[model samples]
Target: MGLQNTKAPRAKRANIVMLGLDFAGKSTLLYQLRCKDVFLTVPTIGFNVDMIEMERDFTLTFWDVGGQEKMRQVWSNFLEDADGLLYVVDSSDKRRLEEARKEFELILKNESIKNVPVVVLANKQDLPGALNAEEITRRFKMKKYCSDRTWYVQPCCGITGEGLRVALERVATFARQYSRSKETFRNLKEMDTL
Candidate 1:
């Protein structure tokens, strides 16, 4: 018999939690990634979950949670199992920048997601007064607050899908790194016990 190869392709999975203030385009970004189309969405009172399959058997499942005042209290419930975070922001809502920054900082400080990778989507870049990625990063004080984790700010338009593909690519790369680090830590712990 001829030599045979029996290797199976590995599937990469990422459980990402998306969060932000109300009307920050979280739901719109979720649907846009899943359907590649703009969808009109009302304020999410609860949460929405969707799966997106990417090239090379990489699959991303996003949990888009409600950002209402009452809903924020339970956000930690979703954070416990997230492999990554996608923090959406209404770049055009200049007036709410401080509020968004406060919320973003709180999310990062959660113990469950202490070192998870974060992708801040500066959504609504097509609007008249939208902030750029640099501006969003500075306004949020990302470099100082996100020092313990891997993070990036991607300026995108949820309606037009601009910059979204690049954002996903960044998430995939970060997820891979995060997974490797976790695996390494587990291995080290097992060795310690041995």
Candidate 2:
């Protein structure tokens, strides 16, 4: 029998988890998306949840988790059924870049998070000596880590919310891509059953 293919439908909702080293502005990014203004933020101790209508057809649930060394132990616990990852980096912190890289490796190695898209926020772009998106991508070997899924590195200033929408758009686009694949798989199964 011949197989017929059709366009898969997009999902109306998505759940994306925000992750990064401490002071990389994960919480600030969430606040900016929610209120359009950066409120003074303390270090996120556990997690923060915020929902946003990134576009008329797409809604997002962002899970911002604490990035401290101890807290990372619990990261995988929250990773069940995650749709994607939003990785924020303090682009100006040259000293801790290695630590950040190691932490990212740890996250990516978790079996629960395979094949999902990633949106990297090269944050603190407003600060002098901040690493640009290209540099951060290269330094972190992002292309290799993200080889199996769609990824985008967006330069941003979390305090001012610059490039936030662009990052969200990338996440939405990737989520749409993911939804299409899932739908296609389900359709294929149904056709086989028929």
Best by TM-score: 1
**Cα lDDT, model 2, residue 51:** 88
Writing each residue's lDDT as its tens digit, candidate 2 over 89-152 gives 9999999998998888788888888887888899999999999999999998988887877888
Candidate 1 lDDT, 1-194, residue by residue in tens: 99887888778788899999999999998888888899989999989999888766888888999999889999999998788999999999989889989998998889999899999999999999899999999999999999989999999999999999999889878877887788899999999999
TM-score of each: 0.92, 0.89
What's the lDDT for candidate 2? 0.88
lDDT of each: 0.91, 0.88
Clashing pairs in 2: none
Q: Using lDDT as the measure, which candidate wins? A: 1
Q: Give the per-residue Cα lDDT of candidate 2 at 74.
A: 94
